[model samples]
Each structure stands twice: as C-alpha cells, then as structure tokens.
Target: MPNQSQIFNRVVSDQEVWDFNVFADGIYLITIQAKAKNWRQNFKRLFSDDDLAVQVDDYLFTELSGKKREFKGPGTWNGNELKNSSKSVIILLPLKAGAHKLRFWVDEAPMLENISVEEMNPDIKEKLVLSLSHDASAIDFIYKNIEIENLEVKYNDNTHSQKSIETKTDTDTIMITIKRPQDKKVESVIVQFKSTIEMNYKIGRIKLYQDIILSSSVNLRSQPDDESKILESLADGEQINILEEVVIGKFIAGKSYVWHKVGAHGKIGYVLSSFVEIQGQEREKIIELIKFWAQKLNIESSYVLALAGCESRYKVYATGGPASDDRLGRGIFQLTNQLKIDLNDDSKPFYSPISDLFNANQNVAAGVSYFKWLNTTKYKKSTESFKKSVVAYNAGTGNVPVVGKLNLKNYEQQTQNLVSCVLENSQKKKWGNIWWPILLFVIGFFLAAHGFVTKLNYASAQNDITIDAISNFEPDRSIRISSATSSVDGMVYFLANTSFDCGAQNCHSVLFQLDTKSGQIRKIMDDVFGAAVDLFPSPDGRYLALVALVHGGVCNSGVYYDIIDIQSLTNLAISGYHSGRYTAEYVGDNKWQNNNAFSFSLTQVNCTGTQRGTRKGEYVYNMDEAKLLMRMEQFGPENNG
Candidate 1:
C-alpha cells in the first residue's frame, strides 16, 4: 500500500510509484499542497535541490475557476478551506482526449490525498437535445429575482428513459415530455427550456404532419402574401405562437421571406418572423446567451437580459420589417442607430449595422458589451436612479429622438434630444447600473400555457429607515379597472387586461423613466404581466402601479419595485403573493406627484363593532387625500350590520 499521507495529500517519497486511470470526456484533477512536505523549514525561501518540476500527463492542462478565479493551487482546485481563498487551481486533462497517465507535474515533493475528481463538463450537448427538459439546471430560466432550490421533473414510466432532478424552493419549475412519431429516430435530445412560458420544449421528437388554417381572407392574393410586401392585413393581430421559420419560398427583389406558422393565431402564413422569435424562445435564448456571455464577461446574465429588454425589446434591428414603417424594432432586443456603435460592420445593410449584433450570438455580446461600457463609463458617479441614462438611450445624442411611436411635440422631442446631448457631454456619462427598477416580470415571456389553463392561478431582508419608505396604504382585494393610468412617475401609466385573440389573458402596463437630460417622462419598459391584468407603472416609477385586496371593500395597491423594463408583463414586486386575487387601479395620474413619491393619504375608520357603516367593512376615508387602495368591504353597511 502507498503512504496514507500521500492518500491524504503528500506524495510517496524516495522510491514510490503512483497509478491512475481517466475516463472518456472526463478530466483527472489533483490539488496543490500548502506546507505538508515540511521542506527544509524554510531558512531562506529557496527551491530545494531534491524538488522535482511538477508534471501531469502530457495531455492535461492546469486551470483555475470560481468567485475569484485562480490559476495554480493545492493538488487541484476545490471549494476547500484556505486562508483568503477566493479561487482554486487544478491540474486536469480529459480521459479520452489522449494521455491518461498523469504524473502530477509537481515542482516540489509533497504528499497528495483525498484524490477527489470533479468534472465541470460543459453542457453544450444539452442545448442540442431536442426535448422538453424539467431539469432547472438543464436550461436557465424561471421567476424573477428568485433563487431556485430544486426543480422537480416527472417522466412517463411507459417510455424507456433515465432522469435525474431535484425540487427547488422559491423557484418555478418547468415540466416537459416529448411526444414522438414512430417513424423517425431522434438525432439528439435537446430540451429547450422556454423560461418565458415556464415550459420545457423537447425538440428531440421528430416533426409530425400537422395542418393549420389560414385567415381565409378573400381579398388577399392567396397563399404566401407577397413576401416582404408589408401586408398589414396578414399581420391579422394573429396570436400565433410561431414555432420556427425557414426560407420556404422566395419572391420579389430584396423581399424574400422566411415563412412562420402560429400556434396562437391558429394558422399558417408568412409574416416577418425573422427577428420575431417564437413566443417562449425569446426568454430562453436570452437566458442562454446571457449565461454564456456572463461567464465570458464576468457579469450577471439577468442584468444583460434586462438591459436588452429595456433598450430594444431585445430586438437588434433598428427598423421594423412588419410594423416598422411605423419604426418599431425587432428581436430579443431593440437597438437603434440612434445609439453609438463601437462595433459595426456597415457592409450588409440587412445584417446588423453593429457587426457583432448581426448574429444572434453576437447580438447578445454587443448588447452586453455596450452595457458594460455604459455601466462603467457613463453613470459612474450617479448612484441615485436609472432615469437619465435610460432616457438618453431612448432620446439619443442631441441629434435624434430614439424610441417610442406615440406622437411627440417638438418641445418634447427637443427636450429628449437635449437630454441625449447633455448625457453625451462626457464619454462615460451613460454608463451605470445595467438593470434596475423592474416594472413587472410576467410568469414567462409571451408564454402559452401548455397544460390546459382556462383559469390562471397566481421576499427577504430588512434594514430600514424613514417612515416614508413604508406604505400606510392598503390594497383593494378583487377589483379591476382597465386602461386606468397610475401615477407612478406621473404620466400615462395603466395596467389593462389584454387578450391573445386565442382566448388567453395577458396583463399589460407602461413603465417610464425621467430623462435626466431633458427632465421629461422616459417610459423605458415593456408592459404585459400575465393572466391577471390591471398592473402598471407608478407615476414616479419607484413602485409598480397596482391595486391589491386589503381588509374589505378592495382597493388599489402599488407594488413597489415591481418595475423592471425587461418583462413581457409586470409581476407584483412582493416575492410571495397570492396569484388569483384581483386588483384595481385609480382612473388617472391624479394620485401621484413625482418620481419616488405617491400622493397617498391614509385614514383608518374607528369601528366599535355594530355600527352599520363600520360593521359592513373597514373604510378608507378622505378620497380627496387618499386614493382607494383596496375595497376592504365588498357589500354595504347593512351587510356588516
């Protein structure tokens, strides 16, 4: 038997042989020793004559990874204890990539032990799996600001399969199963996690023969309406959940198109699904791209996704192919020539002017790259709010007005232009927090409910100060108002219930930011919460504009911090809240005064029991000073009496 000290850490001394074997596509790693060998008691830190240069199998490579990222260390990199250890380095090599015989390339003689081998393999193959995945780790997506503990996945026993999964807390789990046709063999199983819908799409199953209906418009010149002809009629406000697009046919010059079928619109036809992603795909792609680049750029993927959502609806193209004659953008992000371009191609106009943005992969890189610069450069000193910079992005650099289709007066446009100019006065004036002030996070992105949902269903830490921080206001329970704007940042803000035209309910709200440069409202968010409607931005954008149920009559509750510009829909800011409850919004912006403030006044009714009015329900008074938070009472005083 070899020396146990070597088993623990130190290598066998003098005349000893060590044996090892490696597996295919796996790596063998060894940790570095600290002071076990007792090398001559260090009289003067010098290399010992007996110390041999550390050598691993010729194929193996050394690496370091972690919170602090390291290069070389004890026998191998690990989450073990060491003073001020922020990172760990390891000697590693793939088992099948040649050279299994690794002889620790040690510079000094030392004992090695606890030969633990951990393979941090890349799941690049996972992306190729064409199956719906239930594994949270399989694809990154889910609820907002949540730390998922475990995700539970269920498998059908009838199918021959293997599965491994765990349940997570405070996290939403996506379950999936693949329905396959008997004729085709699965090339590979790629579980696509549509974080937007909280559904796992199994792409492994072969495509089945299915037929869909066309709008049957008699006037339209039959199938495949002039590709790129910009037929507003074909848009049809179709609720189709486009599966995917391919270049099926072509016509007209510079007008070739990729055809796409819809699940929501319930038909098949061609529209510009080019940058128009499948309903759930957008969010999933965002996660994958963000995670990939986050690893590369050392930033949070969520923040990147959030910024992309805010800037360009995550669309890369500046002009709209379908609706952009009006100038709306496309893709996971919405970028504009209005913004500066550090990375540009300028060769292919069809391709992104920002060269890196031309490719989907590169698009995320460019988005994050631009944001990284902004975060460090522009907003370097302003630690207060995200208003101005976002405004600047929306408004542009003194020369142009950036986003939004709503009619703008010359004054507002000039103000926006001015704001951009002022923001650009310096090089890094626009860089700051990449993502902040969430407006709302929908259940999933444009997610189509998979398992038959007629009805929809539906946070830690303290450290407080001012009394103004807390809401004396109460939310109304089960009341709803459509198109009523809230005074978040004091502009047009509303939470209205919308239909998918496919009978799906989607809640939507408008989020705004104040252009620090112009001091005008810069609504910088996409609205549409989910199922439950009546959610909107606050007059000031500090708190999400919404109404919640309280003691009785039902009132409006402004969910604070629910304002994120990335979400397709707004989520109540509270991490944990009942989903089925209905809420209402005040009629207009009368209840709000400015950003970070609400014009709410609270009054508690004195109730000693049997008094008719008081008995019926708890009433909030001073309608003039206090906006209705929620209806604490549903019925009349007689009911309570």
Candidate 2:
C-alpha cells in the first residue's frame, strides 16, 4: 500500500506493482477508478439488484498486508448507449513508518483510469455498512479526527438536479449530511466526499429504512432545548423514522449534543439523542426501574411488576383504566387523579403531578407510593389485606362491602384480574422451587384435616351447650344461634337471638354461658339487643365485651357495647355517653390492654344536633370497675366499622 500519496494511471492486462514509503504511523485511504470488462456486463448490472450487481461481481483485487482482498468496480450505465462503465472504490488501510509494496490485478482486461493513495488521521475510516430510517430525507456520514472546513460532499440523484447537503463538526466527529429532494423521489444516490486529510471516498448507493424510541416517554419538542414547547410525547419502544438532524440545536452537557427530527404519531418533531437508541433495549431498563422503586417503597418487586403488567404492561406512558374517568389513570399502577389527591398532597416526595407520571422513575415512584398506602393504611384490616388492597387500588374501597369479607364483584373485573395476577405472580416469585409448594401443600393437607376434626368436636360441644342453655326455658324451636366465642377459661359465651326481629335494630338476643368441663349452661342475660357483631374477652378471661348496634336513625343511631362480668354472671349496659356536644357514639377498633382495662375507638357523631361531622377518640375502659378511665382524641376521622 502507498502510505503517503501516489497515483498510477494505466491499462492493466494482468498484475501490477507500486512501491511507496510511509513517514508517520497513521491510516491511509486508497482510491481506485476502473471499468467493467465489457459493455454487456455493465448493461446487465445497471438493471439488476444493486447488492448482487455490486457485491457478487468482483472486477478487481488488491494484495495488502500480505492478503488479497476483492473489490467491485462501479457498475453504473452512462446512458441508453451501450458502453463499458467505469466506477470508483475506496479502502482504508493502516500503515507504519516503513517501506511497503502494493499489488493489484484484474479478473479480465479492463481500463484502469487511476489509483491514488493519501494519508488520513488514525480515526478516519470507511463505513461500508449503513442503515437509515424509512422516512429519512437525509443521511449522516460521521468521521472522527476531521473538521467541517476540511470535508466536502457531492451527490448525484437521477430524479433531482440539486440537493441540500450540510457539514457539522463537534468535539469528536465531523458529520456530512446529505438532504434528498422532497418534490421528486430518488431510490438511491451516489455520494462522494473529499477531505483535506485524505483522497476522495465514494459510496456506491444510499438507501432509506426505521428505529424505535429508547426512553419511557420522549418529549418531541418544537425546538431542540430543555424548555422548548413540547410537540408530542413518544411512548417507550415506539417505532419512529428519523427525518434529519437539526442544525441549530442546543447541546446538553452530559446527555446529548445532537438533536434529530423524527416522524411519529403522524407528526414531526425534534428529540434529543439521549432519548433514542436501538430497538428492543428499553424493556429491561423499564423492568429494572420498577424493581428499584419497589425496593425504595418497601413493596415486593414481584407484586409491583405484576401490577405494572396488568395495568400498563410496564409501559411508563400508559394511561386510562377503570379508575380513570375524565382525568385518566396514569403510570404503571394506573393511579387516577382522585387517588393521587387522596394519597398525596402538594409537598416534596409526596407531590407527583399528573404530568410527571409520563416519566418512568416518577411514574413508578408514585405508583408504588399508592400501592404501599393501600396495603398498610386504607384496606389494612380487610381479610387477605394485601389482595383486597390491590382490588381497592383499582375499584375503590366503597366497592368492598365490609372489611371482614372480600366479596369482590364482577363489575370490578379489572380489580379481580389484577388481584389474581398479583397472587399468581407472588406465588411464583416466592416459591421459585416447585418442590417447596408441593411440600407445603402436603403439610397443609394434614393441617386442614386436623382443623376439620377440631371444628367437628367444637360443633358437638356447642350443640350440647345449646341444649343445656335452652333446657331452663319452655320447649321452643325458634331460638336460633347467632354468634359464639370461647374464652381462655372453659366458658363458651354465645348470643341466641330469641325475638322475631332476631339481629335487627330493635331485636333482642339471650346471652348464654356453657361450662365445657361441667357440661352445664346458664342464661347470662335475656335482653341482649341488636346483633352482637363480635365478642372480646379480657386476657385473663374475667370480663367479656360485646359490640352491638342500638336502635335509632342514621344521624342518631350508633354502635354501643355491653360489658359482662362472667364470674358474677351480671351484664352492664355501656350505652352511648354524651361527651361535650356529641350526641351519639360508635365504638370499634377494640384492643385489650390488660385483664381489667381495654381501649377502643369511639366515633362521636351528630355533634350539636347538626348530624354532619364525626370526631373520634381512643377511650380506655376499666371493665373490673365498670368505668371509663381516660380518653384521647385522635387526629383523623375513623370509620365506625
């Protein structure tokens, strides 16, 4: 190879040789101009497929670095006139400071116009393989270690006489952009570029092609700047065709120094280089981001992933779901405007504007935030709390009839599907090994059978207790059992509704006691009104508490309780007490403090007869003394249930 600069013009019959020397260690460009063997070959190649014509038919060969490399000569037809066609081929070779020999030959007798070699920077090379977008009206040939002032471009288009070509130079690369004519279509163009650092390089043909969006949601802006007017937000992995690179674009220091004009969503806009990348590369990134936020929010990554999969299939710009009305649900969890407002406020960390949900990081952060709140706060007391919370996250807490039963409805199908998907995904993640589930199942089968036997024994004991409790009364078949609970001691307390109204507001029930060891039962109280929803026994089993509703209107009506001294077999009615301006009180959320004192939340409603607002407080009641010891008002309103 000629290392510096050399030119040979002659007709080659067979083999040829040239001797040259290099003065510096660098890269060099070798340019060759030759013709096809005959006129018939040139005419046949001009009408055939470009790749088959250019790559399959090799007209010349060169021996460089002790190896022979084949090259195709130019196959363009000069005109309708049949004649041998001449073409140019360029190659880049690295050479050290030493003497070198260049050898070349032809497959058939062809005319060799000239062969020239010139010095180039070490980084400059030929990009033989190129791919462009389908809507691309321009192409960029990037060369390193070169300046815009030293590079020039010339292209020949069959359909157009003139085309716009621009040159740009950055810190690393010199870019030559060739713009095609818009009015008329050109299938391919012959591109040639001459640089001061090297001889002329020629590209056979340039064909147009498509790429995808890399970021979750890339903002297509009117201007290539951080604060420019947004044209459209492109979704993750969305297919787009690049049209051109903007000349007057602002370069972001750490992100991107280039901005491309892209066609997508039936519109054209400029996008930063950082936001676009190769296709099929964004999914892993999105999944990793979800895991990152899930860890930060202390939520199971599998559950978050399942939720994202169900809600938006992990699409960051996803919007619209069951919770969405006119405002539209957004992000992975499909958080709606109302839900966001309910769970967050205008504060740092907690503040997630709807617009920010389009970003993957912000979207996952807000979704996981709501997810945690749903599990730990809103539906915290529901059965299968996590599963129910997932349902509530989509369908709202009102759809859930009560906290005790899941009772998810078909109308909330999205919630049901999400819950099922989450449960399945969670099981898969937790039990990675199949044998673990099989072993657990085998263990659970025996435990369930044992539980069934225990339940049968308890039912038989309850039946005996029921017979003894009714033995004192006259024969009556209508005394139905309502609720029952066993204390730490051998006493089984149960409520038997005797009135026709049964568990209704004004209905009454008889409290019965059964001593399992003694095989005897006694009536504790005969006037237990309203259905006893639940029973709470003291830690030592000395006193028992009952939660029951009192008869009254919605505003005046509230939950009351009855405290019973099991040892004395006496019941004390703990009715709603008027504290301050509150008219009625509802008691719930009971927690036993010790053997004598227990605390419960009391929601005082109908204050000053307005029947509008309710205030709640945690009241400590001493069951042994049958008195209220202290009460502390809580901050937020508590549901009566």
Candidate 3:
C-alpha cells in the first residue's frame, strides 16, 4: 500500500490534509489537507478547471461520465474523514473488479495512483461508476457542453462471480459525451403581497446581505430602516421565472413576520411569500438601464448592449453564469480587477462609494472613464494601443509581461503595438467566407478577422508635415533652384497629408513649409489648404523655394521638391535632396551668390522615438561628412586623387 499515510504526509506538508474514506475495496476518498484553514479546507483554488489536471484514461475500471450530478453545498472534510454530513462530495461510483490507476488534481497538482478495485454487492447492475474529463482547449471550450456536478460512488457486491483482469489504459477510454439541457420554458409569476412585517429594500446587489429571522412571537417595528438594509433586501429579479410559492402565512398579533431570502443559487429553500412582491422579469427595464449608460459613456448603444450581453447577460445581480473571480479576471470587461478595495465605495473608501451598478449613468460613466483614462495616460494617441487596454481589461493583466529596464524607445513603441494588437484581435468572431463588420464594435470595413485595418492612405489632412531637401542655386540666395536631389525624388509634387494631435477630442492636420536654409518646420497652410481640401489631408507636404512636394517613405523613393514661380507659387523644374551633404550648385541657368543652399531632413517621425525591434534607426546628417561631400563635389576627383 506504500503507506497511504506517506502520501498524506507529503500533501499535508504543503496543505492541510482533510478527509479520507475507504470505499468498497482499495478505492479511497481523500480530501485536501490545508492545515492553516483549520485543517478543514478539503478543496482549494475556487476558480479552477479540475478536469485538466486529472486523466482517468482508458482502463477497464468502470464507465460513468454521462450521469447527472449536483453540488450539495457547504460540506466539510476533516483530515481523514468526511464531516458535517453535508454533501460536499457528490460522485457515487462502482468500480469493476480489476487493477487500475486513478488520478485527480488538488489545486492543479497531479495526484496519480494505481489501485485494485472490488465491488460491494454481487449484482453491481443497480450501481453505476462516475468519472470526468474535459475538452482539450482553454477555457473558451468550457461553456460549450454539459455542466457536471456533485457525483457519488457506491458498489454492489456481485464481483465474486466476475473475473478480475489487469489492463493498461493509455488509449481506450472514449470521450465523455456531455448532454446539454434545453432552455427552460420560463413561466413568469406576478405575486403581490405587502409585508406584514417591515422589509428592507436594496438598490443594488443582494447576495452580500445577511438576514435575521423573527420567531412567531416577535412584535413588528414600524420605523424607517437604514439605506444599506433596504438595499440588502433586494433579490435577483430572475427569481420571478420559477414562480415558487412557500404558502406560508403572514403575521399574528403575538408573532413576528419571517425574513426570508427571495433568491437562492440552486438550492430550493423557503422564502417568506409575504415579504417580497414579484413584478415579473425586469428584462426590458434592465435593457433600458444598460442603454442609458452606453449613451453617457459616448459608446455606441450596441457596444453597451454587447457588453451587457457578455457580462451578466442583462441580469442585474446575475451570478453563476461563470465564476468571476477565476484568475483575477472580473467585472464587465473581464480584465483583472487590479484595484483591491471595494470599487463600489465612493464615500468612506478612497475613491468614493457608488450606490449601484444598476444606475445607468454611474455604471456607463465608470466604464468609459476607465477606458478613456487608460487611452490617454498609458497609450498616448494610438487607437491600436487603446484596443489592447480593452482586452487586458477583460482577460486579466497577468498576460501583459512587465519587461524591466527596457530602452525607452523600444518600451514605448512595442508596448503600444502590443496593446493595439490585443484590442484588434478580440473583436473577431467566426463567420462564413469573408469576415464582416460587427455592429457593436464599429471598427469600420473588414477588420478584426484580418487584424486591425489601419488607415491605408485615407489621406485625410496634413499636420506638422515637413518637406525635406529644398535647394537653391547659391548659399547667399534662399530662392532659385540649385542642383538638388531627395531620398524620394521621383514622386509627384503634391504634399503627402499627415496628422497631429491637437491635445483635444480629435486630431488635426498641417502642411509643412521648411526654411531651405534651416531644418525648422512651419505650417504653410493656415486657410489656403484648409479651404482647398476637405478640412485637411493627413499627409506630409513641404515647400522649397520653387518646389512644392510630398514624400512617401514606404514607397522606397526619394523626396519631391517642386520648384515654382516665387510670386505665383506655380510649378517649375524640381531639384532633389542628394544625401550625405551635397551643395546646391546651379548646374542649370542660375547665378552665383544666389541663395542656393538646400537642406534635407535626416529622418521623419510621425510619432517620434526609436522602435527597437522595428528597424527604427536614427538618422543624423554628420556635419563633417556634409562639409567633406561639399568639398568633393566642388573640387572634383582631384581631392581624392
């Protein structure tokens, strides 16, 4: 037996050892042994998928995965035995006569075992076996099938007539077939009964409330109760679906009214019928509240609808849909509730107490304000980063790795892209053929499926646009064309539009006018381009003496410097910004002593800063190199020769 006590000692050394039961034969029932919990915590890690840790493989032990089960709440297991006579353990199974290995998990820890099984009764047909396994993927697959619960195991002793065998169980156990229950045809009830005894009414969550019952001899007190008490008395409006009635009487002169809970998790408990009034399911009212918050938050109504649909399913005080505390992810977005205190309290607590999550304005305001704050402070102005914050909000921040002491440039750029990618990925849902836009997300044309469809040359307006390398024939003269070339010299003279953040609700565009003599940037169009184009075009455009130009770095071309008639600002033959430091000499018809020196932008930054892993190298025009290039161009090959 390998001293079963040794196994207990190993586990108990880490956690308290609780109950253990000897079933029909060598089959045993062992509970957790986490001692600090007064040695009573047989089960640990409340939010976990037990099936992932345990695999009862294909051995010929017994077959019992398709049976019904339930959680008989609040049972306890002492170090070596089941206690409290409560139904914490549910599965009752009969093991076939054989030698087998059984396994399960304790807080995700693997507990593997080899065991010999024996039946209690000779005719074991009356009793069945119980076992479980899970879908292979992550939690996304958990909600897809049947929900199994409290299972019990027992044996019938006809085993002496049957032959015992030893078999290896690497493959044969079939996948457990889960039977999903059909949606219940809910029948709504409308029961109106005034309280014979005073009742408290709560405005928000009812699960957190504690209640006290009055015996048949207490007197009724008719004073206004505290606000907290009233709120606690409220129940889940869905209780109206069952139409359960206790048929208990009101109150007598000598007796007091009973205070009973109108809502329960799954247990069929008694409630004082006269204490609560059923107004039917509040689905419509709940929806209206959700919409109100959506508007206040400035999000689309459908976004709010989708949010509520994903969360409590529009059921205020709704629980049991899924355990919220799993992996520290909770609330509407499913992001980790990083803030430790009761976020509901806006008063005595540091952030102040919110009276109710059901309050449309407050709830919506909170959701939007949280996201908006994240967008502004952590993400700068990138829409993509905003989306990541949204995902982290729903999935828990544990996924966001905190890389310590990274180069600031890489930190900012990579983190921004990370968040943006997350936000973009989460909005996808499978559909046929080409994916389409979701009404709730408003992500614009086909996206989410193919990833974020960042603006592909929508070319709105220009903001802080700089035209690089405008040249003049002579250093003295800032006008007139000198021999010049650009990094992107082949493009059209039209300025490429670009964007700038105006530090307000929206972005603004600007046209770039660079001083040919210096690298300074100036906005050229105050009213001209604004009125000419639709508001503004978000592309870069620069003006050289006679040159008007636009540049595209991605096209792998050179800068376009359009030369124009100074007065007319009309077109003329353009020169390019030759790199490394090239002097503007009028190879064409130009006089010396004319302003011919041209300057080229060393680099362009839409949002400035280097990106480590993204080929974002810095560009600097070396003064010494520029001077040397000028001397080489002016003196000819004899300098090197």
Candidate 4:
C-alpha cells in the first residue's frame, strides 16, 4: 500500500500505480485535476492541416477487490484558448472497506495536479445550517435523527420563542419552524437538537435580501443538483428573482458552496450562487423585446437569445468588443458604430436610429436585422450556416472559410460553442421548465381517459401528403426538402434532393412541381446547385424564383439563383460568379409587378479576376421580352451617407 500523502496532492504520471485504503463502505467522490503536458506555443497550429487541433485524453483505470473499471475524464481542448487548458474530472463510485488501486494512463498524458477521494455518504452526523434572507418570513429546520421534544431554539435577539414555533414529524425527520417577528430585526438563530445518540446545533444566518446578477453565462438547471436537466442558460448581468434563499450545496476547501432557487425567463430553476453577483433587477421586458424582434424577422427566438447572451448578456449599457475603425462593440448584440451604419442603410428594409445604440429595443432590432441580412445574403439558410454567420458576426464574413466543413479558429469556435450552449438549453425542452413534464403527463392521462378520439385527430393533423404517379420520385431514400412555396391558384412548388445524380458539380437538390388538383408530381428540373435554400412562386402561377448554395471552393461564388417559367418548363440560371471573377446579378425581393414582369434589387459585391465594376440598383425582368432592364441605380460606397 502507498503512503496516504502519495494518494493526493502530488503528480501521477502515465502507467503509474497508487493504492489507498477506504475505512468505510460508501459512495466516494474521486477527483482528478490536470493540465496538458505539452502545450503548443505556436498560434499557427490552431488551423492545422487536418482541420482539427490536437487534443489530449484523460482516462483512469481502477481495480478494487479484483474488479476493474474505467472512468472517462473531462479532457478536451478548450474552444477559447490556443494553448493547453486545465480540466477536472469527478467520479462517484461505490467502494468497499478495503484497499483499492488506480492506474492513470492514456495515449497522451496530461500533467496531473492533484487526486483525492472523499466519502459522499459518511457515517458522521451532519450539522444543518440554513442561509436565509432578511425578507424571509419563516424557515423550516428538519432533522432526521432528532425528536421535536428534545429541540430548543436560541436567537441573538428577542425574535422568536417556543410559543411561536411550529412542529411536525413523520417516521424519518422532525420539522420545526422558527417564525420571525414582524417588527424585530434578527441577526442569527441557533437550533439545538438532541438525538437518540448525540447532540448537535444548527446555525442559521439571516442576511439582507439583495438583487442578484449573473457574473457569467451559465445554465439554469431544473434542480439544485448538477445532473439535473437544464431549463435554459442565463447571460451575464441578467436578472433573476430568488424564490428561495441560498442553501449549502457542494463543499470545497473547508467552505460550502450555495445553490439558490431562482425564477428567470418565466421559469423557476436553481443557479449556483457563486455564478451570480449581488445587484440587478429582473429584466423580463428585455426578453420580451428580443422575442418580438426575432418573430418579426422570422428567426428563432432562442438563437437570438443565445446571440444576446454571448454578446452583451442583454445589458442595455454593455460595451467592450472588437473595435472597427474608431468604434467598439456596444449594447445588446455588440454592434459597433461602423456596423450600425452599414446595417442601417436605407436600402435595407428594417431601420433603427443610428445614434440609439444604447437603447435596448433599437439595439436588439439592429443586431437581429444584421443577422437576418447575413442569413439571406452571405450564408446558407441552415443551422450550420447560421453558426458560421454567428462567427462572422463576431469576427467578420471574410474570416469564416465557407467551404466543405467548418474548421474555425479557437476564438471563433468558442463563440460558436457559447451560442450552441445557450441554444441547447432553449431547444432541448420545447415546453420549458420542470412543470412541463408533469403538465404533459397530466394532459396525456386525461386524453387517455377520453379514449383514442383525440389521438386520431392528432394523427390526422400529422398525416403525410401523398401524390399519385410522380415521375422520378423515390419514397425510400431520405431526401431533405429544403424549401417549398405555393402560387395563388393552389400550385405547389418545392425543391428537394435528387437520387444522387446531379449533372453539374456541387448541385444536389432539384426543383419539383406538385399539381394538388390532378394528384400529380412533376420533376421540373435537375441540378438545383447544391442545397436549395428558398423558393418563391409568382402570384399568378407563371414563374418560380429560386435560391441555392454553391459549395465547391471559396471563390466558387457562394449562392446562385434561378427563374423558371412554370408553363414552359424553361429555366434562366443566374450564375453567382462570372468567369471574369465578377458577380452576376445577386437578385433578391423579386416581387411580381404583373404576370409578365417582376422587379428585384441588385446587391453589388467585389470582383477578383476581371474588373467589370459591378453595378447596384433595382432591376426589372420582363418575361414577355425575356430581357433584364435596370430601373434605378443605387448609390456607390463613396455616397454611403
């Protein structure tokens, strides 16, 4: 057996063996803290050739009573740092009263800082203590081994006595409440209890009730325990109402950590008190404003919420971010002065006051509007693309490599991780909070009592639409339909993936037309240029406009467009990139002036190979003459004012 000092507070190398003696049979928490053995000093290593940075693994192998077990440690590259990071792993295992051996080794060894084991359920008695707020009207003291008859209450002042106490007991524990006087100020109270075998005293503190603000963005869990389901993530400086005062939770370094039950985002959840600071009012209004703008922009409220959580933590006066020109990041979404000017151009549909960067509503609107612009023009309309756009929002569109798979830098990856973390809490549980499950179960019970009538209605609402005699329509394979639209005359136009046979490179999905009346589906065209993003059908049922991504190289011109004459099955494919490196008509907002003509806005972008000097203006497409005409020229960059 190894010395007790060697079992903890010392480095344990790979393949090294250490033995410890457990005096009691109980669940024990085994903790291991380590850092990367060899950290990379070069920043260029962040963008490695393999697209993934090197990572180290941490796994511990243990043998107790001839039974072996493997425990996975929390060891991975920190998204925010280019260098190696420190990580801790805690595992609770049931250990018998005997000697146990643990062998630590992995492919890439990390520098072990410390390793220790503590019994979670010890045989010793617990001294109960309650951390309450001064505003608390009453608090309960429940003891398992103590009898109510043998309990006494002592207060620092004349706040309460035996006559003012309430007692109740079941088979296990006796609960007693010491009600505070309405006018008197109480500093602290002590509850003395005598069990069948021993006597102990519980010290309770009554401090002033203060507002709390999150110091950093963290998950709001459904329960006080770490293993509980996350309700949602709250941002830094966000406000919450403490439903219950703090209680002693996790213990570390001879000090107890407190977990507070708080109410936020219309739900009650538990948050560690250490993650929150004392000062900030409940800001439900700001949340409602974010939801409103998100709905107006046809974006996910959760995504926008995550963005704000990452940017400014919903703080109206929050500042400090990457500087652009002379301006730094400001307000909810951290929009710089220059970015505000660019996003608030008159050509854009949405508008906010250029000077009101500090206003909460205006700030959120501008940020969300900018995101919408990026979604439509710069990035693909998928969640992955949205993630890219988020990184673009922070770093810049030019920094993000829009090719095969995303291989972002450490900082960019961290931004994506933060947004993903916040989004997980919002999306994982649709109904939100702990009560939703109980509410759903109750509703399910009632529906079951009422028979399958309600179930049949639900099934009917969820029924799939089937078409008869559809050409080249394979029902077997899993094909994702990217976009769908319908004309006024009930004609359905859709874009879906073909059967792995696109003639053009980078084209995956194809255009399809469904005749609802005749029950027929027609394959309109093949090769829709990568994933079909959006479909817009003309009101008179004559034409369908399409948008799709081009996924070859970085300079392969990101997104392309097409216009198809539904009656003639003729397509006008608009190549996103011209051979001369000049961009071809990047058209958007194609509104039909009549059945024969439509109007669209031309967004000019930079060219590379040849300098044709791209044009920006509102243009008209006349179907009768099959000619494109410029209606009005837009102001150049020189006249941005």
Winning model by lDDT: 2
- Ranking of all predicted structures according to TM-score, beginning with the best and ending with the worst: 1, 4, 2, 3
Estimate, for each residue in 232-259, the C-alpha lDDT of model 3 and write its tens digit: 2234322221223222233211111222
Q: What TM-score does prediction 1 earn? A: 0.30
Candidate 1 wrongly placed segments (more than 4 Å) = 1-268, 271-282, 291-303, 311-330, 337-341, 345-358, 383-385, 398-641
Q: Candidates 1 and 3: which is better by TM-score? A: 1
In order, candidate lDDTs are 0.31, 0.49, 0.26, 0.48
Q: Using alpha carbons, what is the TM-score of model 2? A: 0.27
TM-score of each: 0.30, 0.27, 0.21, 0.28
lDDT at position 618, candidate 2: 72
lDDT of 1 by residue, 427-512 (tens): 32232212211112111111111111122111002221111111111122111212233433223342322221101122233333
Candidate 3 displacement at residue 313 in angstroms? 2.0
Tens-digit lDDT string for candidate 4 (1-641): 12133324343443355567778655454544454433243235443211011111111121111011112212222222313434443343444567665555332334455556666434424322222223323333333323333334444464445423345422222334444455544344343323432311111111111111201356788877556799987875565655554544442111114466777788978766434432211134455556656766778777777677545445454455322224667666778887888767777654554656755556887888887766666676445677677777877777776665555434443354444444444454232211111011111111111111111111112233332122343444434343244443645565555322233353366666644344345567776665566676676777887766553333334455678988899999754223233344354565778777767675555444535355566767777777777787654443341
Can you tell me which runs of candidate 4 are displaced by over 4 Å?
1-478, 498-504, 516-519, 558-561, 572-585, 607-614, 633-641
The global Cα lDDT (0 to 1) of model 4 is: 0.48
Residue pairs with colliding backbones in model 4 are 507-530
The lowest-lDDT stretch of 10 consecutive residues in candidate 3 is 136-145
